[model samples]
Target: MSKSLKAICAVAATTLLLGISAANAGKYNLGRKALPEEIKAWNTDVRPDGQGLPKGQGKVSDGETIYNEQCAACHGDFGEGKDRWPVLVGGKDTLKSDDPVKTIGSYWPYTSTIFDYVRRSMPFGNAQSLSANETYALTAYLLYMNEIIDDEKFVLSDKNFTSVRLPNEKNFTKDVRPDTPTQAQQKPCMKNCKTEVKITGRARVLDVTPDAKKE
Candidate 1:
């Protein structure tokens, strides 16, 4: 038999043994898996500079409504934080203070980080439950709460989002901690390294304690 005929017969035998019908067998060409470029098309994420933001509109009032229905229970009505959950407003100059408030405006570096974080994870029980417009509105509401912007509307489109600067934009710096191998290898010692600990000042000094000390 010819080499071509032998190869065709071998394939046919294999297909028959595997119970694959002629109509189904030999109907496809083997190809490589999807490329990174193909996968990235669906994985859109906005960056601090509004790199991947989509076009959408949202108002602070609209966000208030959404927050009431979906987020208020956990995040509080005004983003003041519920129970032990984190607050989403204010903070500002507290970054340099001892007891920093660490709110959205005071601690967050990028406005886009808010949208990106919420898009990726938020609403606690049902993450990614909010639409782009809803996310924008919620972001605007948080901004209002932080006094970054007055109670105005904010629609987080690529064009508008990049314009929103965070109040604590300078609070955090890029990781400048030495990346040198020696530094990375060194473990910080916790005990008795300093010759003396001085009480230069108190952070929160009270006139008197709630309970008086024994005489």
Candidate 2:
């Protein structure tokens, strides 16, 4: 393509992206306001307290089928994870060890997060494809695989989602950081934080594997 043609194409692409941005942002005056349904499509986050959880239920058996067909490609048959994909189960007593295996059963604090994440951004490429029931079923299946729940027929739903808590639930504390921008977690650490300040630096590359006794 000629330079002028390429420039024209680039301008067109930029205009298109800006138009889209303006449409979604709802700030600029050029694009029309987003419809209520359109806004709702993006507002699908479920809170930790099951606030936004949709009414749906699924059994572990159903979850197993879905996992085998839709999830096992990357997360493995038993949530052991394949390649660099995240491991989803086990790691019960390894938190205090040299390497902490943070998985659904091991490190995640809430069951609602399981449901929310699965429904919102799971199954890899085909995100937001799973329904509420499917997500619930997968959550139940993961719970079964993690040995948190033994019954394969156990059903998970929004009604009892808050009741189901992970082993490390008590470990995760609420973020008390200030809402305003102060450049600190809560407040600026100006005084001596440690008894004796020691400058130590660690490499960024850390091979933290998700592994534990499956039996």
The TM-scores, one per candidate, come to: 0.64, 0.65
Q: Give a tens-digit lDDT track for model 1, residues 1-215.
A: 99999999999899776764433445463444567998766576778877788778788888778878887787788787889998886566776789888878778888887888887788886887788888888888777777777746544455677777976676565787566666456787788889988898753454365565544
Which run of 10 residues does model 1 get worst, by summed lDDT?
Answer: 21-30
| Candidate 2 ranges beyond 4 A from true positions | 1-34, 174-215
Query: Which residue runs of candidate 1 sit more than 4 Å off their true CA positions?
Result: 1-32, 35-42, 151-154, 176-215
- Cα error of candidate 1 at position 165, Å: 0.5
Local distance difference test values of all predictions, in order: 0.76, 0.85
In model 2, how large is the Cα lDDT of residue 8? 100
lDDT of 2 by residue, 1-215 (tens): 99999999999999999979966775555657768999788878888888888889999999999999999999888788899889897788999999888998999988878888888788889999998899989999999999888977799887888878788888977788776687755877778866876658633334344663333
